[model samples]
Target: MRPPNTPPARAAATATADDTEFRTLLDRLSDKATEDYYNPFTTFDWPATIPTDELWMSPELLSFHGTELMDELSPARLQALSRWESVNFYSLNVHGIRELLIEVTRRVHTPGFELPSEFFHHFIGEENDHMWFFATFCLKYAGKIYPDKSVKLPGAPRDPDIENFLVFARILIFEQVVDHYNVRMAADRRLHPTVRHLNHLHHQDESRHIAFGCRLVHLLWNRLLERDPDDVALRELRDYLGRYLTTSIESFYNPAVYRDAGLPDGFALRRRLLTHPARQAAHAKVLHKTTGFLNRIGVFDARH
Candidate 1:
């Protein structure tokens, strides 16, 4: 077995012919990130108070949407729910960005990652700015950012290539799910201007991030296949990623969000909503693009 710290042979060879297209894409993305940079601190005029009477998120994107739960709540209560849910959403971003940053920082400039290090610099900076603005919005307006409650599962031992693939794949899944919400909320005029602008700015940066992530994930997965041309490893990867996707979707339904909105039976409500057919359909809709991409790349079985 290779030493735990050693980078894979396939990964360390930086000038393989297969990498040519990826190199060109990386250059284009890095230049675009430089050209489109913005000061997140000054980009927004933070309002003294975001009105609580208005919706903070697009109603259709709400967890309770398309369910009987929607009709059960009065307008005032619904607005309260939207406010807290909005805070919860941004809180998730702060936590998710922190995790991805750590993972990316660890790999940047490490063996096998030399070519992408330049773009990694841009990615790391933008994501830090993202985490800052997200946390700022949460603390400035909501008084606190919700604590991350995601449970990390123990995994079987794996080689460096597998570990690296899992890290980037998880990041890609997280970004795609978030970009779904960002795209919708940014275009939603019904939301507060601060909320809309935050989403719009995030979506702009994430578009490039998502593009880079997709290419990198595909490259890594292909490298893994070349190193281990076996069905067992492929099956394991698919199963692990499938569970990660489910967990990602389930994080959106935080019981604390319901409790903060003054709803009773917060945990019970979360459970019921999660199992509801309408909510299931909504989950599938939100994850459609991400799942389709994975399927096309053969990371996921089409039958799933």
Candidate 2:
């Protein structure tokens, strides 16, 4: 058997004698991930049934959880909404992780990028598993996965350094944001057993991914600083990330989910709930940890 501390042969071979501390950190983290890895396929007891009448997501984590709008919902309506909201959350994971998978695979095996590339292999494998289970649950329960809208706001920086940094930064942001859901829902006993188990499984893998992402951002930022050092572009990237977070937060307030849940004037209801002061406060609270970490790492000067 391989020693507990030994990273796989591929990863071990990539770490040279003069590797930087950053590379060493990546190596250690990758080793730990391998040692602690779980097979996403068989990790959970895939329930033959999931009870929709019971809460799928915690009441507090729902988009309208603390708002007046939620108070208006009957117990039955609230339970129904929770089911769809859980679908939306999982659907978002499927699409968001797909994007990151593309970005990571594109760069994983490129020449002259061997150190972190070793870890990218594991990252790609884990993400594929995540997409599979998330999509599977959504399809089995909701009948379809949410489709992603292909849209990017204009004025994005064209610099390769800025572009590359944005990819990893955005991945970190998405993971951290969804992690807010995973951490809470996983521990809440009020949710269905299958739902709680899925959350627990995701949280287990993401803890490693989040650790790697934070360090990756710092490393990428150091590279961008040396090569570009353009404050204007940096700020633009930060603002872009802020926009990404806002849109991600708003996705939970989906009009379709509201409409299907039998709510009237779905669009109008979405607008009200999204603009409510309480919901606005909740958005900030949800993102606080991620934004705070990014700010500390010099990715942004302020919270998103």
Candidate 3:
């Protein structure tokens, strides 16, 4: 990690860290890239095209607080929301995946990481295909993908090689974080077949990604420890990840989801659900998964 409040003369910001997070994240990236490299081409059993006539996604899955706002909607509005949620969720995935893919591309070829260097080529290929499938759905059905939100964070700008790992970690964390919805949608029979398949496929790939991330975090964290016992980098990483946790919880409150459902009160409801103790407990599930492994390896502090 970059020294906190370091003077500019010491080094340029985002210069590579010599720690193990850099090496570990890259290897995981390479592994995922390798696993997902032919993702759509090999994995998806597409036969011509799935019909889009019925409800694409379940409305309940899109609710801001797991409460029904759609029950209050006029039949026409209710139907529109069902259609919109399918598109909305898919669009969000496209946007989120695009950000993750770009991060993967930027840091994949950064110098000095030999193992990652080998796999970086495959990482880009996998993401490119993932993007293609997502974009294809949006174009074929909804006309275009929704634009990405403008989110900016100011922490250490990662060294290109190191950046790949941190960025990918964030991506993995984000996925597991929001997986409550994905899992719900994947199983909910009320959703259209196409919607179920989309979540099912993404969830399948995400399982591998999550596994890769868990192992990588240990390898990198251990490496960081060997480099420095009382390293400030670990603190920075914890703090950064905590912030990521907040964002993951907040993403579920789509004001758009509310307005379409005819409940302008959706934003307020979102605030409550997102901050609710029960909801927060739900968020803890993934943190538990990641932290348990980190603890078992003796690399993590039990305190959040």
Candidate 4:
């Protein structure tokens, strides 16, 4: 076996003498960023007015944890369920993109990262415009944008060091988790035309976001390993990541959704979905992607 100091040949093949050459990893990453940069600002045509609709969600992809409850609703109520879910989903994206871009701005400026910083600058620009469209749609059609929640997950407070690596990891994790559902909506040709269009656009952008995010987190983790090799620290990071997944999936069945559905008790239903087996499985799909990425980065219990 080769010594630990020795580079794997495939990696060595493309590495520079100064730093290990990563073959296509950096190039592909930069390319994706470039494409996002070029059209990110102009990717979608903003409709002057959003059409009125009861459901903004694609039914095929609804988590279905408590969807049978839908059978109890009148036609109008059922339509409201769809609208609430779709608007809630996109509104969260708008909020997330705003916060994440701010983080991206700070990271793009760290020492010795000049070469790679350009992509992040462009990435943030795209996200800024993306936040605009999503927020605009909600304002124009929904009459009000969804507000951010004060919910806190179980974890250490975000310190600067953690924010540098951990926040990006958190953002990356939650976004892919979103794709676990949004992908279904994007492909469901049966959804309302406007809903379909919204999902289709967001899905396209998020595809690139997840790609860069996975690679970026892995890159950040490697840097962390060089500084501290503690297994506990690594595990804590993974646990924090797991908490976000749990909390985020739970956010799907919000009080607003429950109240809009005309359910008398909102918090109780939210609790049930968080605990229900079927819903748990759907939630698991989101966590699994993040866990897998952590495993690939040598940060998790990989025995599986």
Query: CA shift at 283, candidate 3, in angstroms?
Result: 2.8
Best by TM-score: 1
Error of 2 at 9 (Å): 26
lDDT of 4 at 248: 74
Candidate 2 regions off by >4 Å? 1-19
RMSD of 4: 5.3
Which 10 residues in a row give candidate 1 its minimum summed lDDT?
Answer: 9-18
lDDT of 4 by residue, 138-221 (tens): 777677777877376666635444555777787887678777767777777666565566666667767877876776666666
Q: Where does candidate 3 clash, by residue pair?
A: none
Show model 3 residue runs off by greater than 4 Å.
1-55, 58-83, 157-165, 178-184, 229-231, 286-288, 291-300
Ordered by lDDT, highest first, the candidates read: 1, 2, 4, 3
- Judged by whole-model lDDT over C-alpha atoms, candidate 1 comes out at 0.88
Pairs that collide in candidate 1 are none
Model 1 Cα shift for residue 215 (angstroms) = 0.4
lDDT of 1 by residue, 104-175 (tens): 999888777878888999999999999999999999999999999997855633878888888998998899
The full ranking of all candidates by TM-score, starting with the best, is 1, 2, 4, 3
TM-score of each: 0.95, 0.89, 0.69, 0.81
Give the backbone clash total of model 4: 5
RMSD of each: 2.9, 6.4, 6.6, 5.3
The C-alpha local distance difference test score for the whole of candidate 2 amounts to 0.80
lDDT (tens digit, per residue) of candidate 3 on 109-132? 444233454554554565466567
